[model samples]
Target: DPAEAVPAIAPTTVEEVNTRFVVLAELYEHDIQDFHALLEGHEAGDERYAERVDISARAVKERETA
Candidate 1:
C-alpha cells in the first residue's frame, strides 16, 4: 500500500520558472515607474517628498495584501 503514492510533475524546466520571473519583473518595473513619477516636479530636500514616500509606502502595503 505504501507504493501507491501519486506522482506530481514539479516545474523542472528553466522556461517555466523564467516565465514566472518575467511577470514579477514587469510588476516591479511598473511599481518603480510609479514611484519615480510621484517624486517628479519635486526638488531634493523638499518636504513634499514625504508625501510621495507615504504614497509609495501605502502602495507597497496594498501590494502585500494582494
Candidate 2:
C-alpha cells in the first residue's frame, strides 16, 4: 500500500536538518542566479557560452517545478 511506500525518518535533531536544508537552498539559488547572468552574457553575442547557459537555465527551471 501507499503508506508503506513512505520511508522512515532517522532520529536526527530538528536543528541539524534545518541547517542542512538552508545550506542546500542557498546553493540552489546561487546556481540559478549565476545561470541567469550567463544567459544575459550569451544574449550579448557570446556564442561559445550561449548553449551551456541555456541548458543550465532549463535545468534550474525543471528542478524548481519538480
* Best lDDT among the predictions, by candidate number: 2
- Per-candidate TM-score against the hidden true structure: 0.45, 0.50
Expressed as tens digits, the lDDT of each residue in 1-66 for candidate 2 is: 989999998888989999999999999999999999998987777765787899999999999999
Model 2 residue 23 CA deviation in Å:
0.2
Q: Which stretches of candidate 1 lie over 4 Å from their true place?
A: 1-9, 41-66
Model 1 TM: 0.45
Clashes of 2: 0
Which lDDT tens digits does candidate 1 get at residues 11-63? 56888889989999999999999888777645454667788999999999999
Per-candidate Cα lDDT values, in order, are 0.84, 0.92
Q: How close is candidate 2 to the true structure, as a TM-score?
A: 0.50
Give the per-residue Cα lDDT of candidate 2 at 49. 76
Off by over 4 Å in 2: 1-10, 46-66
Give every collision pair in model 2.
none
Highest TM-score: give the candidate number. Answer: 2
Model 2: worst 10 consecutive residues (lDDT sum): 42-51
Positional deviation of residue 42's Cα in model 1 after best superposition, in angstroms: 4.7
